[model samples]
Target: MSLIKLSNIHKRYGKGTNVFEALKGVSLDIEAGEFVALMGPSGSGKSTIANILGCLDSPSSGVYDFCGVNVSELNIKQKALLRRHYIGFIFQGFNLLPRTTALENVELPLLYRQVPKKERLRISMEALELVGLDKWCNHSSNELSGGQQQRVAIARAIASKPLFLLADEPTGNLDTKRSVEIMEILQNLNKDSKITILMVTHESDMAKYASREIVFLDGKKKSDTKEDS
Candidate 1:
């Protein structure tokens, strides 16, 4: 089964005369270990699809399947559980806690999961090492550079070993060099660890790092293409 399947999905906001349709009959499937990029300008429905895939919002109509389960039909609590257990989210902003060590910040999610301290430490450390941030684990967010801070954010996202990573404009706030570095880390994670990744970005340059590109325009999929492996 596909890791994620969206069949004719739609999303509308507001009501009646003020209704704004964000996604119109959108359909897509992401198999396991695929690195897919969702790209478009603002209001093009790329972020709308990402929000739906991340379980942050429900589709107005149609179905969403993840790992063969119907996510559109799940309750709020169930959706929250799905996000907590299966999705690792990375945003443009480095959401790391200020004044906290990188290791501690990475362990925050596991704390919410009630994992034992020992195991949490181990997993967080492994995630940091994956991003080549092990040596900086003791540094505070303020002590790190923009790229280092973003690396910590990625480590935090992967600490739980989530089924997939959802990255929303992850390189938006960095310089060109740092942006490429971050993309390389994501590409490596997808290539080496077989981590499924769905990223949303308007930057064509960053999107190239993903194996597949899915472009959106006017709430519809404009193109879906895969590069040679």
Candidate 2:
């Protein structure tokens, strides 16, 4: 069974004369343990698809099934619960609190889930270690470099051991070298941990890291191809 399935999905903003369609009958299926990349020009609905995949937004019409559940039928609270338990997100901005330590930043998700303090600490540390940031756990967000900050962000996302990760231009703010490093870490996580990943990136080089690439144009899927390993 597919981990994610979207059938003839559509998204619209406003109504009538003011209406704008962001997704036009977009459909896709992603299997578990696959690393997929979404690529497109600005306003191509790549971000719209990403948001829908992450449960940040629902499709305006059509079916969206996630792990066999009809996500389109879920209520707001149900969607929130699903995201909290099964979905992890990484953003381009690194989104960490300035004064907070890396360990604390990673623990924030667990706190929301009501995990015990000791267990949260343990799991957060493990996540940090996975991203090779264990030594920087005590360092504040401001003290870290761009790469380190992104690692912390990745650590935070994986702290809950989510079923899948949704990364939105995660390396957009990094230099070529740092971006490559981040991609390597993500690749390793997919290979070694069998974690599913859906990443959005404008850079073709960055997209090359994924096992499959899906391109969008004018709110429509243009191509979907598997990369040669």
Candidate 3:
């Protein structure tokens, strides 16, 4: 079964004369363990789709099914629960707390889930290790490089053992080498760990790291292609 399914999704902003449609009847499916990239120019609604998929926003109208549950019909609180348990998010900005240590930042999600402190520390450390940042766990976010900070962010996102990950322009703030390093880490997570990932990236080079690429134009899917491994 598909991990995610969106049927005839639509998103609009404003009302009456100021109405603007951001997603025009968009539909797609993401299979379990798939590494998919969403590519589009600014205003193409890629981020809107990302927001909807991450449960940050509901579609104006459409069916969004995650793991066979009708997410579109879920209330805000229910959506929050779903995101907390099943979805992880990585963003262009590291989004780490300045004064917080990498280990603490990764533990925040577990704290929200009310995981026991001992277990939280263990799992958070494990996640950091997966991202190759376990040794830097005590380092403050401000003390790390952009790549290291992003690794911490990734560790935080995965600490909850989410079913899937949503990454939005995750490499946008990094240099070419750093971007490649981040992508390599993501790719390893997807391949070795069999974690599902949906990434939004404008750079073709970045998108190339994904197994499949879906392009959007004016809020509509323009193309969907799978690359040879």
In model 2, pairs of residues that clash are: none
Better candidate number, 1 or 3, judged by lDDT? 3
Overall lDDT per candidate, in order of appearance: 0.95, 0.96, 0.96
lDDT of 1 by residue, 1-229 (tens): 4999999999999999999999999999999999999998899999999999999999999999999999988999999999999999999999989999999999999999999999999999999999899999999999999999999999999988899899999999999999999999999999998899999998999999999999999999999999986
Q: Summarize candidate 3's per-residue lDDT along 1-229 as a digit string, tens digits.
A: 6999999999999999999999999999999999999999999999999999999999999999999999988998999999999999999998999999999999999999999999999999999999999999999999999999999999999999889999999999999999999999999999998889999999999999999999999999999999875
lDDT of 2 by residue, 44-119 (tens): 9999999999999999999999998999999999999999999999999999999999999999999999999999
Pairs that clash in candidate 3: none
TM-score, model 1 to reference = 0.98
| TM-score for candidate 3 | 0.98
Q: For candidate 2, what is the total of clashing residue pairs?
A: 0
| Every model's TM-score | 0.98, 0.98, 0.98
